[model samples]
Target: MNTREFKDMDLSAYFIGPKGENADIFKELTEKLINEHIGYRQNFNAEDANSISEFEKTTPEFTNAVTNMKETLNELSRKMRSGSIPWTTAGRYLAHMDNETLMPAILAYNYAILWNGNGVAWAGSPVSTLMEEEVGQDLAHLNGYNENGWGYVATDGTIANISALWMTRNVASIPFAVKAVCPELVSDKSDWELQNLSIKECLDLLDKTGDKKNEVKAQSARSGKNLQKLGKWLVPSTMHYSWQKALDITGIGEDNLVVLPVDEHYRVDTKKLEEIIQENADNHIPILGVVAVVGSTEEGAVDHVDKFVEIRDKFREQGVDFAIHVDAAYGGYGRTVYLDENNNFIPYKDLKDTFKEYDIFTENNQFLKEDVYNAYKAIGNTDSCTIDPHKVGYIPYNAGGLAIADTRMKDTLTYYAPYAFQEGVAVPASIGQFTLEGSKATGSAAAVWTVDRMIPLNISGYGRLIARTLFAARKFHDFFNGQKFEVNGKTIISYTVYDPDYNMIDWVYKEEGNNSLKSMNDLTQAFSAYTSSAKGGNLYNLDIITSDSNFSPATYGDAPVKFIESLGISGDEYYKEDKLQILRASTMSPWVYDEKSFNYWAPRIKKAIQGKLELISTNENIL
Candidate 1:
């Protein structure tokens, strides 16, 4: 786990990736777009794609959308690089990106390897590559990871969560699996020994659960090395759906996954989680790693890390074994700036007072911040965690991260070579190596470094920036809550500081006659978009946006754009069902400062809502 043992940790030396071996792949992609984007665009391809047929034929959207998306992306990239984009831009997708290094990072990454697939490792991403251990160590140190841990960088939060889960299932179950099916080999006859296995392992041994025999056979089939261990993984019901996805990949039935309930604040009910762990403990239902969330997706809910550590301690005291995986994708980076009413990290006790002002929402969700985020003051123990620079760190899109508390977990899951294992990798930088992913990109690492330059991952810097966003959230909450709008039912601008986990001041304007997801989505979208539109009325658009998409038709088409839209939310959307359009606000931009930003934008949002009401009231036939 020490740097000397992992001496070759630097991946920047020879070549970024597979290119050290083969370089042509890099040439082809660059050649495809070379001489394309050196300066500001004076001209653009006419919107008419039919005129130029070839460009429209193969991956038609690839050329058109790719060009458009990249153009806008590059613009935003330049602003982010310069710290010139207003805080308003942070919550919305705009022409301005985070930083210019984003381009160099991508170009260098693409220069390093030609990846058109999954990004699991060097073997899979020969063209993409492994990063230097030394650099990764720096990342570890930044996140306050334990001194001697080794880890891999995943493509996104979902992948990172899956990787952590897989590691959890494997390390916890493998040894138990070996013992379960061959129980006769053991000399120990104590009842406590049997309880040490997974529910599946213990069931396989007892033929106990309803379908005992079938369970045994299924587990036996899954035991062929690939799935030697899997049973119940204790995670919050509030966990990301990806945990279910990980279940499918591991061949462990999702039915076996235990979802511990969440508290009023939407945090995992750590107490309930422990009861289940203790209940199953003596029964041999091995409690796999306990996955806690530092920043949950639904409400920005943060699982109490300190409480989780306490659970870890109690479980260990009970002689039970499990790892703790912290899903801090949304909130991890905030750990550094978790200050007192003032800011400081050295005297770091639970300085929960700094968050006192935000706690007003906990009563009626009428305030800016809440007590929940303050709970962050208590964090300590962790096994592994997910951190995304793309999120709170404000790096450009597609940059997520993972940091494990226990560096030893890397050793538990590492792949080695038959001959001398290189100090860095026993794995190679070509396809079909030891990875669940296929291709890779080093651009992410470069971007991580670039943004860290702008905002350090310590308590003072990054935490301060994130705190501003929360202030913006609270400001928007107050503005929306106090204002009068035309919705029939109670107009709830839900940035109920009660849940600091929530990003948008979800103004659930239930139109008097209809408040279904579809109706709500339509109305809310209209309210947010029109208010946020630069062309709307008096508002300058300031590049700030925050609004969510409706999931009512219960389909997935607009979920992603809807989520992205909420970031600095507001934009046009092509609704497939009714072909209706509406405006909305995402209210997550820090540019929503005191006098200048809010004064200009809030009135515009109100006016937009009024205009929409007039439309709804006038169109009785449509309703």
Candidate 2:
């Protein structure tokens, strides 16, 4: 589509369905449901009690509560006015929140809320329980796990991550438990030696433990034992805060969580990962597992999953292997790039043109980049994954997912409460038995299921939406790095974008000067003048996220700090503060798909950058 015409494209078409047919059908279905189920519960034969409204009138306390609620809502409405993040304003956003959702999801959630269904079990929410099962299947297929695999929804990425790690810790210990109890199955092998054993070997050893096969089938319950035999976990430095909680809750002590170094792109260093595994092995610490972040919380960096698997395979050859869990809470759905409507792999050549057409064409595009593409493609190869539909899937709040490549992994972590799920029962049938949390919201599952039905979890669906968001991010990156301001044919200010990994810079700002805190702070102030609500203006008010780049000599040492200093970028100062602030933009708005809309938004952002630099150069306090 041409830029101007693209601007006019009806994005809601994706939400509402053909000719608004589904929207009308949905409305009609909801009305019918209300008429049958909730259209006045009182029968004509029964005398009516006092209505809730009448009670409010007669009871002062109830009336006061109502008044307080109204007052609070009024205050909230007033505060909401100052909020400037517009979902429709092209791709000028730098926030991780996309603020995009579909009509079906909203409608489905509304439909389910009236019932207030809990998905913990079939008895509580019959329809929603089945819906959740369907949703799990949909999510699994997206990550290349078929019906043979197993997954379910959780409250958020935190719970999903914890669940995945909890499973890993338990599964890692099964071999050790068997070795201690039944030495013949794994002759002379210590628990540490058994940790690296292949899955087949682990299962054989489990059989020898004489803990009835039924226990493995339905024993996700926590033993509360500090099974030190599970050993330590390896994770990239860019890990989410939830990992620590996973370690704490799983009884894997904080000291056992070994954080590894990340490469220039903020991805886990594969070489370093191997080194850590070897070092742990040398020390006789049975390695629990390695974590590969599919989409890091900050910077949205993707780790080398493909390389992780390759290294793991090599380790397997040496009788040294460990579970690999992918924390793709943010980026798992980005796997849409690799699949088509039928969940079949699309040829790279075919995808290249579509990527180019979307203006996301770049060497850094994961689908185009061999290593990155393989990383995404290898998601299903991992033991388990955390995928949040609430973030990229555009579903309503509190819907995260955990998918297991091998359904057998669930055998170790299964927990059965007599009151919740009976012992010896399989999950989904007894879904609550397998999860960390009980009493889950079935409405969340309905929302995901309803949306996936309308928006297929494949290339022509969510993939296209994601591609637009990515294009927007790349566009902003290019504009900030490349644009130069000119007045009356005289050269003026320019800005630099920090993309040390891709090296995607114009050097216009670099030639003028290097990046400094003063420059960055000035830029922030000027940008705020245009985009901040207090300024009575709006365009693209960028937000900055800072990270602790500086570390103690033991944690990170002087080498990284020295490297930044070598670039003439004041690394010495940042080293002391333990900060590396970067301007991040999340072009997650689908509206940015239109070139015309993005073009309109892009220029103003450039103007803001140029204007900031000019103001700073003229006066130190002008900002």
Candidate 3:
């Protein structure tokens, strides 16, 4: 695709419409979906007697019930319309990780629901099970996984994260299980060496056991023993809360989770991470795994996975190894921005020319920093990753994905259900055996499959959408950084928390010549609450809605010290109160990329802030 083609592409065609502009197109496709399913049912066993007669269809009781259903549906639609966030609108919604789902995904989900296919078992969903597998393969490919890798959809990112932890714990125990079941297989290796085996090494040992694989797994962590041998899991403070939940669920006690501090930019300080890993090794404590976040939930920071790979390799040379998993639920799809039409990763040197060819970025606004680019490129080298289709793939809900670098990882967590597979099948066409979830809706899988088919995951497709969001984020970041307001004779200046690594912008307001961190936190909190719908503020009165988050000394561990001090806040004041509040804006709406829309909304957003500041100055109780 060329720049002109990208510019001319009708992004509006992909949505039902912000104002019903594409309603006719959506209706036509929806009717086609219903008719196609009905036609298939009518064609099957045509010679057999009909289940329902014409008389039954015309019954007054049935007719009345159908009318009541339509009326109830109308009432529900009205309620939803009145209560839902206007996510599809460009300037109205800049909060959270959600956006308007792509039209293809929505329609495909609706179409598949009519059949009610269960993805857990091939017996329950012969057709959709295969489709789900294909969707998994597509995700694996999108994440740059090689041919030996595999992936599958989970309920959501939370489930995916838990599954990764569970797999890691079980795989960590395989060497112990092998030593017990087949002593000869590991007679030369000591317990310490076996405990330190890499994920691949453990799987290789399991393969050598062949028929005894089951016996070995019976003694593994999944069987509820040898868990302590798995040692500690390392994660940055910016990690999602799901990691904590994963620890609780996997029986890897929360105390076993080592929380590393983030650097000034909110990325895991790799130097500190290395020191901790080395300390663990020197202390003879076994290590389970390390999680690197591709996009932190609060700050949109990208941890350096490339640095992680280098550290892992350096340790592996000294007989130390640990699995590396990337939690990319929010930024995985952004990898498309670095890929070519053929899905090959575009080298950093060539990216400038490519951007020029696509007319996507301004000369001064190359959003792909060297660290972020290298982090994304290193995804394929990791053990596994959690990618949410709902977050960045623009797919509907209930479509989170887990991509494994090696397909053998599946065996570590596999379980067989007697009733879910066929007797003669060599490899059962089902996902239940290898997943954390059972009886999942295949409609979510269909939604992913449909979107991947209609819009490729490469630069020509998803990349286009991602590029627009990045552009919008950069513009917003520049706009806010340059903005200032005078209210009640106090000059207020805005500063971004950090230059965005992705599409989210975290910013705060500080009063001129004011060094109090508490006052700054108060002002930002009041501004956020004034513009928020959840704070009992009227949405219609605001020009934009944004989310709010806090950073505290307890949770962030001195990470906010530099950011707080940058605003001239006294270090003593920060230590005294120890909290920083900021407003977060997620620029996932492509419409904000339009110059006219940006111009219209930017001024109004400033006016809203000025109004809030004026109101807060008058009401000391607002804080």
User: Which candidate number would show the highest TM-score if scored against the true structure?
Assistant: 3
How would the candidate models be sorted by lDDT, starting from the highest? 3, 2, 1
Which tens-of-lDDT digit does each residue in 1-623 have in candidate 1? 32231112221221223112324544554665444432213235544344546745577566787789889999998766554333323223211112222233345444333333344445444333444233355445545564655444456778878777765555444344434555553336443443244322432343332333333333442354434233477777657788889877876668777877776455677777778887887676766667877766545667777777777677767666666777777677666555432223434233344333333122232432334444454443466677766666555456666666555444334444433234355454322122344344565654565444434455334544555555556666566553555444334332122324534333444344342435545555554544344223433333333334332212223333443244233323324343223222333344443445557766765665565555554543223
Candidate number with greatest lDDT = 3
RMSD from true fold, candidate 2? 6.1
Local error of candidate 3 at residue 599 (angstroms) = 2.9
Enumerate residue pairs that collide in model 2: 94-585, 219-414, 220-413, 220-414, 220-415, 221-414, 221-415
Number of clashing residue pairs, candidate 3: 0
lDDT over C-alpha atoms for residue 560 of model 1: 34
Error of 2 at 534 (Å): 9.2
Candidates in order have lDDT scores of: 0.49, 0.65, 0.84
Q: Which stretches of candidate 3 lie over 4 Å from their true place?
A: 1-9, 47-60, 363-365, 422-424, 536-542, 594-597, 615-623
How many Å off is the CA of 413 in candidate 3?
Answer: 1.7
Better of 2 and 3 by lDDT: 3
Query: Could you tell me which 10 consecutive residues in candidate 3 have the lowest summed lDDT?
Result: 1-10
